[model samples]
Target: MTGLRYVYAVCRPFDAPLQAQLTGVADDPPRLLPHGDLVAVVSHVPEADFSEEALRAHLENLDWLTATARAHQQVVDALTVVTTPLPLRLATVFRDDSGVRQMLEEREAAFRRTLDRLNGRVEWGVKVFVETERTEQAGSEPAQPAPKPASGRDYLRQRRRQSRTNEDLWSRAEEFASGLHTALAGRADDARLHAPQNPRLSGAAGRNVLNAAYLVSRDTSEEFVEMVDRTKDDAPGIRVELTGPWAAYSFAGDETGRGEADEERHGESGGESGEEKTGEES
Candidate 1:
C-alpha cells in the first residue's frame, strides 16, 4: 500500500474475478483501483527497485528485466482472461495512487474508446521462419557436400549454383510469408507487423520472415486458428507459429493521452506484438 504503483492495465468494470493468489510484479497481489467507470489494475512495488533511476539501471540487467517482464506479462495475461484490458507498457510506474488516478482522468476518453474497440476481441501472434538450407535437403538426411572442385572453373560454377539456389529459397520464403499475412489480415479486425526477432534473443531456429499480431473476435477464434493450422505445411522449409486469445495487446493505445515525455520514456510498450523494452533505454 506504500510503494510506487506498478500499473499493468486499464479496464471497464467487470464482474469476473482475478485469481485469489495472483501475484504481480514485485511479488505483490494486484488490486483494482477504480476511478469513475474505469479501473486501473495495479500492484505496489518497492521504490528502491521501481524508481525511475533504479529502473534505468535494472533495465540493463537481462536477468532482472526478464523476471520483471514475465511478472508484468502475468498480470496482463490474467486481465485478458476476465476482461478486455488496455495494457500499459512494461515497467510503467507512478509515484502513488494519486498519480495513477491522474493518468486515468487524463486518458479517460481514449481509454474508453480503445476498450470499446477491443471488447470481445483478442490478439493473435503469428511468425514464419524459413531455413533456407533445409529446403535443399532431401528428407531428414543432411545435404551431401559438393565434391571437391576439380578446377577453378568448376568451383565458380558450383558457387553460382549455390548462390542461385539460396536466392530462390529466400524469394520463396518471402512470397509465402507475404501471402499468408494477406490471408490472415483479411480475417482480422486489425493487424500489426513487427520487426523480425533476433535469433540470439528469441533462440528460434531459421530466419524469420514475418512477425505479426492480429486482432480477432472471440466468436470466430476457432476459424482463425484453423486458418493458421492449414498453413503449417503450406511451405516446405518454412515454419509457422501461432499464439493468442491474448488480451488485445496490439490495439491498446491512447496517443492523445500520452505526453511527449511519457512517450519518450515508454515508447511503444503494451501495444502490438507485446514487444518488451529489453534492448535499449531512452
Candidate 2:
C-alpha cells in the first residue's frame, strides 16, 4: 500500500471554493500542487490499488471502474464551477509530487496553450440514434420479382424488401449524421466525431449513427443545447441525444489518455477515455 499521486487536472491558480469534502479516486480528497502559474489537482492513492499491475486488474471490474469514473467526474465538475479545467485522462498518475511537478513543467507551454484555447468554453456530447420503423418508401425500390421463379420466391421477395429498406435507412442515417455534424459544428467553436457507441456500451438501442463532442462557450451553452434540441425535428427517424456542459474531455491533448511512456512507467494500460481512468500506476 505504498503511496502514489493520482493527478486529476491542471489549471492556472484560482481562489474559488471547492466542496468541503471533495475526494477524488478511492475516496482520497484532492489537493493542489503548484508549478509557476499552473496547479495540478492531485490525491494520494495506494500503490497496491493504483500501481500499474493493480490498475490492469481493477479496471476490468465494472463496479470499480464506474465508481472511479464517477469520482473523477465529481472532481472535474467541481472544478468546472470555479475555473477552466484541462482534465487529465483517467488514471493519470506519477510517482510523487516532485514527479508531478517536473511533468507539469515539461508540459507547461502546451498546457497553457490548450487552456487558453479552451477558456470560457465547456464540452458537450451528442449522440444520434435511429429507431427501427417498419415501412416502405419511394426512390429505393425493391428488385423486380424473378419471372415465375422457384419455390422460395415469396420469401425471397420479402427478404429483398426488408434488405432494401435497411439500406435506405442506413443511407438516410449517414446523411443525417453528416448534417448533424455540420450543423452542430457551425454553432460551436470546435467539434470532434468519435466512433458510434455500442448499444450495450451506451445502454440505448436502435442504431448509434453519430457520436460527437463540441466545445461551446459558457455564455452560449444554452444556445448550444437549444440548437441540439432543434436538430431533433430536422431528422424524422433519428434521435439526437445531448449530454453535457462537461469538462473538455475530448479536446484534451492525448485523447487516449497519456502515451506509452506513462503506461510503461507503471506497467499498466492507459485510460480508454478521459472519463474512465482504470489502470495500475507506479
Candidate 3:
C-alpha cells in the first residue's frame, strides 16, 4: 500500500524499546521519526484512508472514528512506558517522513519546554458524579408523586417543597465538585477543568458534576491517589472516580498554542505554526 504517515506523539530520543505487540492504524507497527534531539512516534497507513480528503469523510463515520481513536491511544499508551509522550490529535497525518521532520523543526523549542515540564509527569483524570437514584434496598417507595394533590393548597405546598429540595441538591453539588477539585489540584503540578459531561453523553448513572484533569509527576502518583481517596468521606453522596497514569493528553497544547482541541489542520512554516490536540476520546 502507498505510505501515509500517522504521528502519535513527539518525545526526546530514548534508548528503550516501544511496547511489543502494539500496532496503530491499519494494524501497522509504529516507528520512530527522529530529528535532531527529538523523536516522533509514527505508523504507516493507506494513502486513501488517511489523506486530507479521506479524513473528512472518515471522521464523520463513527465506526471508523472509534477504531482510529483506539489504535491511536494504544500506541500512545505503549510509549508512556518508556518516555513522556506529548500526544497529538487523532487522524494527524502527513504525506511522509519529510512532513514529520518539518513539524519537529518548527515546534522543537516548544516541544522541549513541554517535555521539561512533563518529564516525569503523567496525566490523571478525575470525574465527580452525584448519585441521583436511591440504592436498591430503599424499598421502592414512590419514585415520584404517588397521586395528584387533593387541593390547590396541597399542590402549592408540594411545589414549594420540591423547589427547596432541588435548590439544596444543586447547592451541595456545586460545593462538593469545587472542593474535590481543589483538594486534588493541591497535590498536582497543574490542573484543568473540562466541560461537565451529560449523563446520556457520559453513559454514567449520575450527573457528572466535575470533570477535570491533573498533571502529576509519576513519583507522586500514589500521593495524589491517596489524597483523592481521603476526599471521598468528606463528600458522602458524591461518587468520585479516578482514571489514568495516562499520557499528558489534556495538558498538551493544541494549535494556536492555546492548549485546546481545535478540530482543523494547523501546521505551516512560521514559528507559531503548531500542532492541534485534545484529550483522549476513549
The TM-score of predicted model 3 comes to 0.83
lDDT of 2 by residue, 103-192 (tens): 888888999899998898998888888765523423256545435535587778867877887777778988998888898899899997
In candidate 1, stretches whose alpha carbon ends up further than 4 angstroms from where it belongs are 138-145, 254-282
* Candidate number with the higher TM-score (2 or 3): 3
* Residue 4 displacement in candidate 1 (angstroms): 1.4
Model 3 lDDT per residue over 1-282, tens place:
458888888889989998778888799999998999999888888877776666666666656765676777788888888999888766777777888899889989999898888899998888777664432212435465436889999889887876675556657878988988888888899998876765553357777788788999999999999988887755545677888888887678762232112111111111211232222111
Q: Which lDDT values do the candidates have, in the order given? A: 0.78, 0.76, 0.72
RMSD of 3: 6.7
Clashing pairs in 1: 250-272
Q: Candidate 2 at residue 86, lDDT?
A: 91
Residue 95 CA error for candidate 1 (Å)? 2.5
Q: Which has the greatest TM-score?
A: 1
Model 2: residues >4 Å from true position, as ranges? 133-152, 255-282
**Could you list the CA RMSD of all candidates, in the order they appear?**
5.4, 6.4, 6.7
Higher lDDT: candidate 2 or 3?
Answer: 2
Compared with the true structure, what per-residue lDDT tens digits does model 1 show for residues 23-136?
Answer: 998999999999999999999889899777777677667567667877877887898888888888777788888888998998899888888898889988888888876867
TM of each candidate vs. truth: 0.86, 0.81, 0.83
